[model samples]
Target: MSSSPRRPAVVRRAPGKLFVAGEYAVVDSGNPAILVAVDRYVTVTVSGSHTPGVVISSDLATHPVRRRWHEGRLTADGAQGGGRPRGGPVHVLSAVETVAGLLAERGLPVPELELSVVSTLHEDGRKFGLGSSGAVTVASVAAVAAYCGLELSRADVYRLALLATARIDPKGSGGDLAASTWGGWLLYSAPDRGFVLDLARERGIEAALRAPWPGFAVRPLPSPAGLSLQVGWTGNPASTASLVSDLHRRTWRGTASHRRFVATTTDVVHAVTGALESGDGPGLLHQIRRARLELARLDDEVGLGVFTDELRALCDAAEGAGGAAKPSGAGGGDCGIALLDAAAPQDISYVRQRWAAAGVLPLPVRVALEGIQQ
Candidate 1:
């Protein structure tokens, strides 16, 4: 008899994202922030392998990694003279390890597989700070889980990706991960990092992955009617980690100024979310301006210049066209977004030209309708 048909290869796609508001503040204490998953995506494909090892490859990597499952672990042939495999792309390795750990917890054998990743989130080999890492991690985990004949819900995939990311950097707010997992427009609050880390350490990866995450919440918001968005890239990548570290060192956590910043940002987020739900174009613009001003105040108080000259010029150009603009993420550089009022729509072409003249390249990105596509 013919052998049973081999399972087809599985491919998963997750989108990059940008913060609409609440950048630095979100990491503080689960503050709510708005984010949008963009059209650009990172795709991961996985298939069973006849060879006795797993192969992981990515366009971002210099070489593919070949690993074998032995003695309850994955190890490369020459990795540390037969010790556990270490040192591939951290994000990729973390994703694989997370999948392996979960499967092991369920008494499932690690399968031999081939995995590959491709992404359109970078420009000229420089990251656009579009949350590529989070997209890749989500896609990788989804693809691997499918290859193992397991299906994961959107929420479960998100928690698994977040857990894997936490293994690498526990300080992440998970805003990007949420955008990649759920897609579209979202209001997200990060879970308590300390709690998550402790649970993972004490109860293990499986328990943490299955547990109800505390202090984490994600709500989908409808795109406001009569509102248009435009993104401009500064062509310089900003290190989110560095910006967060600087802000942490400069601003005392939970102090009066910090509390004021959080409260103001929370109010701005509430206003924006309400405007979105109500489809109030003018109200959205008003809240966007207020939010940007709050960020400016936070920058001054912390003595960290999150808004650079290019970003300021981009925002100024947008405002000159009667639109509201501000830096999208932790903005030493990277991108800024402009929200144009529909009733008084500015010429987007003219806005783009002005942004170009100000040394910012306008990006063709929109809110992705779907989150993770499998």
Candidate 2:
């Protein structure tokens, strides 16, 4: 039976993510990246709907939007000409539609759900670029699925969330989605999104979930035994999608340089994975530096604008303090992560001091061990 209107609300939360290694290169299918889920989160609450359609509200938006599926996609109530829903978050809506599609395939009626989202992934109304999009989507999928009497596995939730976000950005690596789904440190490889998208279009979301996704894989990695992850926020927020779009639009897009980038980045990611597995802290830091250099080379070759003055300062400060640091994701300006000797409290303090002097704010967030949580 569908969740009754008198049933209690269902709440799910998902953690934000940091890209430890691999950036632009992970966009291509089968390429690997390292991502760690952070303590910051996006929480989604689903309740019985009172409106004729689903009502959605988010701290990120100015007002709630009422929407109902049109054919299959969510459309705003009273929308003229069947326009797409307005003032509605695309990620949340995608999760809803994807899960709704799954329920339909199961011969179940779609329940009317009112969703409310609150996030700690931002500060002063600005984002930290800590995979807020991915976190929110994962949380939404879990919450809605649970409310509708479906209990999904971690992998199933991830597959649904991946399809939702991939619909928004086809070239995305989905590393953030993986991190948000599994939590902790992980080695992630991109699936052939083309293959999965085709499967979804032809068969359905349920079929896509059960199918073996080519080139997509994730394995957990232990946290370094002797390193501390320090995060520094550059007050400026960056649009990862925009930064990635720049790379894809470049004349260097399909060139030999891009291929070299993919090969070299894959090597760095492998080293990072091995270091974590062996708890080799220093080796992990060294490879992290190499990852930063690889990203710098990619930027030089493609003018991808992956770094800004603030992010450079963020990394330089950490390096000066004897730690290895780099922008967590596509850079531009967001957060940079540093790996410092866990035993060297002094060095960690010094890195924080230097970041402060350079106008970078230190964020106190740890790697979250859980991803989407009930």
Candidate 3:
């Protein structure tokens, strides 16, 4: 008699996040940010099937192919070897492959299974500044681990994510993934330097900050409801590699003007963080507007000035609706989120419709609290 094939189990959870303040500045000014995880998430689950291969699915893609362990590369199309290369699936496949390899090393025979992926975040090419990639990575890693009946800590997940990301994108600050895994506002600082020496330097600096950086209180932002509209857009999805390169070049030149701008932005980010927590709507609006104005000034120098008409209009409309607005991603176009309190629900609806008409996609997102869970 033939033995019954073993079935793998499924695992799932949501990824939460929020950018309370200090986003762009965090990269340059060494300012900290106060983040929160609302309720949104990316869900993933794995299960065994009688079939002889692995199957995966999501809105970003359809099933490609299931593959046996060591048979060959498993494409998403369910074909043995005729998979066409694509964006989203490529990453997904890589993640699965890594997990499969890990399992095999642990003496678990590879099993054919179906993998399902879903996300509440708009991966429609928008950077909400809420760590979408990190969140997705965590979710994917978690699913894989669950299927293998393995337990991995948030730190483990974060490390795994960094590895996976390196294989795919290869260049990104691990801050997003750190926040996604840790789930809170943070001042993510790498070693004060870039290596062994840097580590020692960072330790010394932390000892110094232990006495000065903690007595401060960050204010709260007023209720989001006070805003008449919240509009968001996806910018051009600029490469992080390029952004970091420019930062080094400019800073090395000791650009005084850029330094001053960064200082001012740090203050603004601090103010906004306080406002969001305090639920001070008017305060939030004022700070947001100021932040955007400053961003406008630094845009060209920082190579972030290429705003699209949709972004411009959204900013204008937010002000018209008695609120504030700003781009959500790396700028050149990823996504812009706006807030307006003076407008009624109908007004907000109208603004949303208008943006949609303009070919700008809008997403309804709130702060997420639960970071990642099984």
Task: Give the number of the best model, judged by TM-score.
Answer: 2
Once fitted onto the true fold, the runs of candidate 2 whose alpha carbons sit more than 4 angstroms away are 1-4, 78-87
Best by lDDT: 2
Q: Go through the candidates in order and give the C-alpha RMSD of each one to the true structure.
A: 3.1, 1.6, 7.6
Work out the TM-score per prediction. 0.92, 0.97, 0.67
lDDT of 2: 0.88
Q: Which segments of candidate 1 are over 4 A away from where they belong?
A: 1-6, 50-53, 67-86, 343-346
After aligning candidate 1 to the native by TM-score, how far in Å is the CA of 327 from where it should be? 0.6
lDDT of each: 0.83, 0.88, 0.57
TM-score, predicted candidate 2 vs. hidden true structure: 0.97
lDDT string for model 1 (1-374, tens) is: 01223578999999999999888778864789999999999999988777666678888778987776554445666244554646776776678778877787787766677888889998767888899989999999899888786678998889888888887777789899999999989999999878887887799877887787778999999987887889999988998888887777663666998888889888888899999999888888888888788888877777677788889988888788778889998888988999876565446778888889988999999889799997
What are the clash counts of all predictions, listed in order? Answer: 0, 0, 52
Q: What is the lDDT of residue 303 in candidate 1?
A: 66
User: In model 3, which regions exceed 4 Å deviation?
Assistant: 1-8, 16-21, 27-31, 34-41, 49-57, 62-90, 93-114, 119-132, 166-170, 178-229, 234-254, 342-359
Give the CA lDDT, 0 to 100, for residue 138 in model 1: 93
